[model samples]
Target chain A: MTQQPAKKLYIHDVCVRDGFQMESVFVPTDAKVDLINRLSLTGLAKIEVTSFSSPKAIPALADAESVLVNLNRVPTVEYTALIPNARGCERALKCELDEHNVVMSASETHNRANLRMTRDQSLAQFAEIVRLTNGTVAVNASLSTAFGCPFDGQICDDDLLANIDRIAEIGIKRLTLCDTTGMANPAQVRRICELVLTRFPELTVTAHFHNTRGMGLANCIAALEGGITRFDASLAGLGGCPFAPGASGNACTEDMVHMFNAMGYDTGIDVANLIPLANEIPSLVGHDVPGQVMKAGSYDRIYPMPDWLGGKEQTRLAGSGNALIDPECRVTEVAK
Target chain B: MTQQPAKKLYIHDVCVRDGFQMESVFVPTDAKVDLINRLSLTGLAKIEVTSFSSPKAIPALADAESVLVNLNRVPTVEYTALIPNARGCERALKCELDEHNVVMSASETHNRANLRMTRDQSLAQFAEIVRLTNGTVAVNASLSTAFGCPFDGQICDDDLLANIDRIAEIGIKRLTLCDTTGMANPAQVRRICELVLTRFPELTVTAHFHNTRGMGLANCIAALEGGITRFDASLAGLGGCPFAPGASGNACTEDMVHMFNAMGYDTGIDVANLIPLANEIPSLVGHDVPGQVMKAGSYDRIYPMPDWLGGKEQTRLAGSGNALIDPECRVTEVAK
Candidate 1:
């Protein structure tokens, strides 16, 4: 067997922010703080609490300030906000944010549609935001649609590299290469992550994948193979790309944690603590979420035999000389 | 960038047999033939049409003989059946069957519960069935719960290897290692596949993964890295462990074909042709299947502009501006 490269992994929970952003009900600001606080205690490396976008643009996150100021921060957990512009950065700076996550779409059409700005204009704004946040809050320049776009097709490596170089040069150390519309495959993720690493060897590459095509975890596996250690995931798989109505949620954090943890890689996040919250997301979000781990239960969680199978179950268990049924088998026959 | 090994992939669609067995609703015998005939035309390498078992045991697939005899057999596709014993072998021998797929769970508990026999008993039965089929039909000895079992925690590699060795010695050329419970991770998959290859170098290894825990595709990816080229998939992700209620179906054939074909590996199955069938499965099975490519459309299928974004969407083409909006974006803009 090939030796698996075990490394320290970082999981950043984006449920309260990125997840709730897609919710139209506008999750109460107190609930957002409660979730973030609970997530912080889960030993996660980071928690993206809320987006510092124009409240007028996204009324769902109009209470970003309220959510952030009330956060019960753990010293080890980094708190971040998806900052859209200088105004968002100014607001984030007031809240003692650890990271200001500025984003621009790699596709021009997506940038204008999503952010109401040109690619060049978005980059310029990010650079200025980086300058403003430097020495105070860390900057995460996220390039949405880094793999492919909804309005445009594939984003060429050259354009992505150029963007990465500009962001890195501006002293922003973190970069989130996002499959904004879940357009990335394993090979594509591996190739793009490799290209990005080769260009900016010092850049921290965080994978932000969507499960739109049911490849969120698969893509994460490929990125891990490509040597990426950080990933942006949503608890309970709560978030979908606001743009793609039919697309699924971000890679479910509990699912990813389960895979990495079961494979003996250390993410340092407690999966046991994340389960209740993950299961609660469907109710909170007013719909079914795309998480599989919760539905399937943890890998080691043995299921009891269904009541319908009791008669057949008895014949098998009592019959097999080598049988050792699960202690909690649901279909155990009563003594005759 | 590290090079991806582009190998020829064998996709065996198990929708008619394994998929239908889980459904309480008995899909009519004609519908079974129709689905199998449609699947045969999809350029799939293999189509496991039905299981040759006691009709009383599984009422759903009692018409295995009629289905096999009536197949509009594709010259390129191999048709197989799940043969449990000499009786099954006798039934399959009557038809022009390509192969007899005999299965035994690696987990003793699961083997006993599912097959009403000990592991050794099942193995002995497979050997006898092999003797019965002789040179006429190929035998694919499938070891279910080879990765992890619902009743048992983990199947030890040594016991598994021994079971595999004995089966191989019995002249079964094709072996399928099944994650019957969908409890496998990528690393675990890679580890086991590597072990299997290292031991029995000449055996044709096939991965039988379920999307139970949502890691089906991820496990497939890892198996590919471990030098496996054959996979057992079901159309529209139809098939679940009858024993495990909440677990999802097998990895969808179209999804796997899409992933492999997109990565430049040759599965030779056309994804476009599989889509309509994938969509048809939910209604056929009387419930929702976990297939995603069907729901979200293909990975590259671009969505059109929503009404409010039209002026900007028009400007996107009508003007040089990059502008778009998420169809569900809550910030549609309040009237001034």
Candidate 2:
């Protein structure tokens, strides 16, 4: 009898590229290397290592080459970099990359604002970057603002499909439909995914969602229902578009892994291993991260009962409703 | 010609109860009143005003009676409160409440921990609360931890149905199935809603979700498709159960409203009016709120170029290979 195919979910960790870019403090090159190295052990399918952008645009990833060079590469994991143009692609190629990622915004206005290029100009740049790199490195085109654009209003589903078709025609290895501003709802996500998958049967479509509008995971589920098997998430919900105003954070990788694992879906990621790396992020960046799992602990992380738990006083308090005192009141009432 | 019935969605704001209860600082009674007054103008169907737990248990709502007395009640809006027991019910009976909300956990352990009663005992108390009130106020039975309990693993769907049946037998006006720990997935949501609706078609059901595991909104959509129209949301994503480990925040009200409005579903809520109130929440409580729309702004609120100008930037971003950067790059670089 043929062995049943193992059911597994693929997660692409975007912390190094997307997560750090949103932070107020710049993470060091060594820290980025250490972060990616730690994350690699967590069993993520891919790690978006860095962005090959001009140093002037994003000061955070100025040492992208050094960070990539120092990483402990896991044989099973794919490491990728974001290339905004042919120049960025050339820089990525110089790093001896196995794969290069390019992005084009679905909205014309956003494309211009993001890359300072019109739609044709960005596509032309992508095709040229693909040619310049040759077949040595894989090319994955990310369609930004696929669900909705921050600068432009609702993106028509046809508009998104058209972008995918153009990218597919270029023979790119993969496509990630990004909800750059978290404007997608489940129905819209389902409709878009269904349309795209129907048109591009051979394309490997992935989802990248931001939690800007509180629908990140919801959109992810919709995409999964729409037949998507891969997703991009950031640790501790770190990362936002460096160029996109008002965008907050990406969907938390640990949180996503926790949800998928709880639902009996295999994500390959170990939530326990991911937690330490997630917690280290706040100290590295000089601010608390957006992810809750790192600070609050996972569903299975148990706290030992207090020393007074079995005592007579504890028994009295436990049985009474007074033990249910509002948690917030403790702070103010004590302060007073 | 017969016009199709306008699709309507109901908004049940949980700000006063869920939102305030989760915060670290205690909101003054007047501030709570002012917030509810502003929210009343936004066309919410119901507002969960306060909880009638003992002052010793939930000191944050020590002024619950005063807040209830001062509410600027709208003609169409129903004001509700959470009643924990017979004493809590007696306290709530003093207020001119349109509805009294009672809760029982599906998990026996959780019911014991949260209410100091077993699941059966909690249900028994709910029956008494129902009998004592005698239809004087609408009683909404909220089945907490209905999706899955943090203490216990997955809650059986049959157990949820059994609880609903027990509550319905007591003549409760409505029921809300709560994913207290955000353990619900879309498929599970669909299955539960279908099973419940099929078994009890006359019962009005609402969905209460948390964004803990990122599937909150996804689960909501699944319920919507499963024929659920009512939902509970907290403004600015406020509220978490302190006693319930791993619980984060509720679904953001403005985000849900935005999705409903964009999908052409009528929620009768003014999305624009909600933004200012959502924005003010972080300052009132001395911490940043979790909701994203108030910070990110809506799709239409972004930069807009006048349409009458026949702007060159309005051109489509995708079409043919003419949009390609270079054929050589497309053939060579993107081939892998």
Candidate 3:
């Protein structure tokens, strides 16, 4: 076997902000705070505690401010919140967030459709948010539909690069290429990630993917292969686009961590610690979550021998015996 | 974007055999034959229609002979079946199958636990089956637990290579490395596939993966990158190890095709044609299958704008407008 890579992978949880925002039922402030606190103990590199979205705009996350204020902050884990505009940034600043995550779309049509503003206006708003922060907190711009736009289909590479250039020029040192509607194939993910990294070596690039078409984990793997170490995922695979019909959730946090840890990367978080917390998400959201590791356990989980095999010892003994009546022989008997 | 590769990928559907065997409800023989016939028109390279095991052993597929006789076989597609031993090989030969797929496990504990035979016994059985067929039909040997054995944990490379050497020595030209319990991680998959190809250049290495832990599509990509083109997938992602509790089905066929086609590889199978067929599986199996593309639609599926956004035309008009009274203003109003 090849030696396991020694690189450390950073996992950022956005279950509360990005995930909860799409839920039809309101996730209570206590539940949100409790979930964040539980996740804090799981050794994640970062947690997007909640969003600073307007209550009227995203009523599901209306408890964002309350969740932030009530959550017990972890010193080692950077706590961040989504800042949609100047007002959201101002609210986030008071809550002492370590990072302000601003959003826009690479596609002009998607930018208008999602944020109700032109791409230029969203960029201007981002610049104002950076100016408002005044270096008090780090700002990360999440370029939604950077991989592909649901409205415009595939976004042109030149347009994507140019948008990143504008975001970087506004003093943002971090950028997240969001597969907003899960249109990214692995080849596209690897190619764009490679170009972005080569073009902006100083910026920290993170991949945010949705498992809408079952390509979420695969896309994340491709991004990693293309040299991205930071990823944005949701606990219990809890996020999806409100406008995208029949879509599943985000790249599941526990599932992603489990795969990485198994592949010999140091994710710093044990997936065993995350599964229990993930299991509770169904009760919190009042629906089943799309996480597999929580349901199947980790790959290391050993299942007991089937009862029809008459236990392992019997099977082991019968395996070498020529006896025709043993459980080993039963397969032939049943077949006949 | 990279130029799409011209390499042809062979997708083998095992839903009727591997998938149906795991179902609690025995899909009627007519249903099995109908599903296989529908899948045949989708440009798949091969279909494992059913297994020739003793009917009593797998009651769900007790009508294997009936299914083969009743279904209208496609001219271009290769029809194959699982042949457990001499009896199965005889049954498969009488049906005039294009290929006979035999099986064993690389790990001894798993071999005994699953097939009620030691590794040696399983290999001997494979040799006997090959002798019984006498080169009349193609013989492919599927190595279950080749990636990792749930009972024994990771199988040693030396042991795995030795088993493959024996199978190849026994005149098995086509071999499938199966992650029977979904324990194979991507790094391990890539490494093993590379080693197998380099060592056994004569054998046609196919990857058989399960999405038990949500790494199905990712592992398939890794295997592809490792230079294996043939894949074993199930429609609607049906089929899981009956002994592995909470295990998910096989790598989803449509989803796999969707990813490969999107990545510029020619999978031959059109995902759009397969989706409608995949939609029928849940009703037939009496449970929701773990297929994402069938549920979420393909990545190209464009969702209509939310009703609150007025419509695409209105959004396009409001996108450049400075007017605050348009639907664009609703986000701010609602937030307030």
Candidate 4:
């Protein structure tokens, strides 16, 4: 039997920042701190702690500074924060974040709606943010709407490449092509990532996807096949854009970790341990969470067989069962 | 750019039988009729309406005969039912089902527990069912646990092939290799489907997968790449073994239809229409369902921009409009 070559994939968890921001309820600062500390112990390469945004804009993440300051960061886990502008960058720098993420949408309509700026202006702002930080933090410029945009039907590959080239010129070494509205197909994912990797070999391109269209994992696989080794996932599939109608949750961290680990790839995250943290979200927020893995549990957690069945082979089980039963015999009585 | 030739893949919706049977609430016979009727209009080539099991065993699908009799079958739709034994075959024959499905788990433990028989006994029962049905219904035998089994890990390919060969000798025209517990990896799925399709060119091999490990879609893609086209998906990711511990849901019907349609492969299913039906299941079952697309809705649903916000070129003019402000200076907020 031939085995596929093993690959190392970096998992950047965004459950606290991206995941919590989308929820209606504001998670308490202490809870956020606890959640971040819990996630740090799970062997994640990076944990996106919070966003440095105005309190009035995203009230849910208003306690970003307190949350960041309170987090018990693991030595090996890199803690990052989302910085939308120079002001946000300054706020993030105050927290001494190891990395800061600045995003620009590829689609002009989404750019205008999401960031209230054109693509070029967003790029310029990102460049300014990078300069203001003075290399204090590693800046990851995320190209949102790289696949297809919710506002616009389809995004052109050339437009996406042009943006990547511009970001690369701004001295951003790390980049992420985000499917903000989850409109990306695997073919589109492969094409976009391949083009970027081929053009900017030195740069590391990460993929951030939503399960809105149910192709999140497929797109991840396509990106992996196209030479991308970094990805952003929300714990238990948390996070959704309030502005993007019909947008589902982000790719579940547990699900992604499960896929990578099963496929002979190392994600450096313990999927089983992540479940409890994932399940805590719905209670933290006042609504039902979108994640499936937390509710369903991992594949290894088995239900106990009936005790009444005893030593005799259990028969007439609905699906797959363990006990042996005689094929020819008919058992009329139900086990009490 | 060269386009890959579109593969012709088939989808067999098993929601009525496999899906509803696992549910705690008994879906009314009229509702089952309505659900199957809606699915038939959605371009499904095949639909498994019910299973010919004893009413005492599976009370949820006890109305199998009534459900089949009431279905508004469209032309080209192959309505099938699961026949567990010779008695079930007789019941299926009486229902006048277009096709009768005989299932046997490849793992001895699963086979014994699920069917109350050993491997050989199950095969003998399948043979008897096949002989007794005598073309009244097309016989399609499903080999469960073809991948890894929970009880017995890592089922060998030769074991599955031997079963396939035995079923072939009994003149079963169609065979489905089921990942009963969702234990299949892509390479394993490809290898088994490739072997089955190559060795039994006359038999129509279909792949049934569970999303227990999140590799359901990947495994399906691998099977398609390996030349096995037919697949089984449950609407809204329904169906799990109540007896099998840790088993969750089947591969979502809406998710699968969305992928196939996006990939330009025709499964003869309308994802747009099917999505609504998928969404309806949660309410019918009185719980939040596992499938994401149904809850999130499709990617095309448009979100209305705030009236307070100016057009795409509008510059922010209010308190904390800064968050919505684009990084690009293409649009500037004018004092209003």
Tell me the chain A TM-score of model 1.
0.88
Candidate 2: residue B141 lDDT (0-100): 89
Clashes of 1: 6
lDDT, each prediction: 0.81, 0.77, 0.84, 0.76
Q: Which ranges in model 3 have alpha carbons more than 4 Å from their true place?
A: A1-5, A306-336, B1-5, B243-247, B305-336
Q: Mind giving the per-residue lDDT tens digits that candidate 1 earns over B222-270?
A: 8988889899998888888654565568988888887787677878887
Error of 3 at B185 (Å): 0.6
Q: Is the docking of candidate 4 incorrect, acceptable, medium or high quality?
A: incorrect
> For candidate 1, what is the DockQ-based docking class?
acceptable
Per-residue lDDT of B1-336 in model 3, one digit per residue for the tens? 754446788999999889998777889888888889999999999999998888788888888889999989989899999988777888778899999999999877678876788878888888898888888899999999988766555677787899999999998999999999898888888888998999999999899999989899999998997889999999988888654456568999999998888777778887989999999999998988888888777666554455665555544433321231223211110000
Q: Pick the candidate with the highest TM-score.
A: 3
- B141 Cα displacement, candidate 3 (Å): 0.4
Q: Summarize candidate 2's per-residue lDDT along A1-336 as a digit string, tens digits.
A: 754443588999998888776566778888889888888888999999999999878888888889988888998888999999998987888787767889989988778777888889988988898799878888889998887665455676567777877887777868999988776766678777887888888888889988877677777777887888899999988876533345458998988887676555778877878988888887888866667666555544322223433334333234322223223321110000
Q: What's model 4's overall lDDT?
A: 0.76
lDDT of 4 by residue, A126-213 (tens): 8898798788789998888787665454666567778888998999999989988786666667766888899889898899998776
For all the models shown, what interface RMSD does each have?
11.6, 12.9, 12.6, 12.5
Most accurate candidate by DockQ: 3
Q: Which ten residues in a row have the lowest lDDT in candidate 1 chain B?
A: B327-336
Q: Estimate, for each residue in B190-225, the C-alpha lDDT of model 2 and write its tens digit.
A: 777888889988788999988665666767777888
lDDT, model 3: 0.84
**Candidate scoring better on TM-score of 2 and 3:** 3
Candidate 1, position B188, lDDT: 81
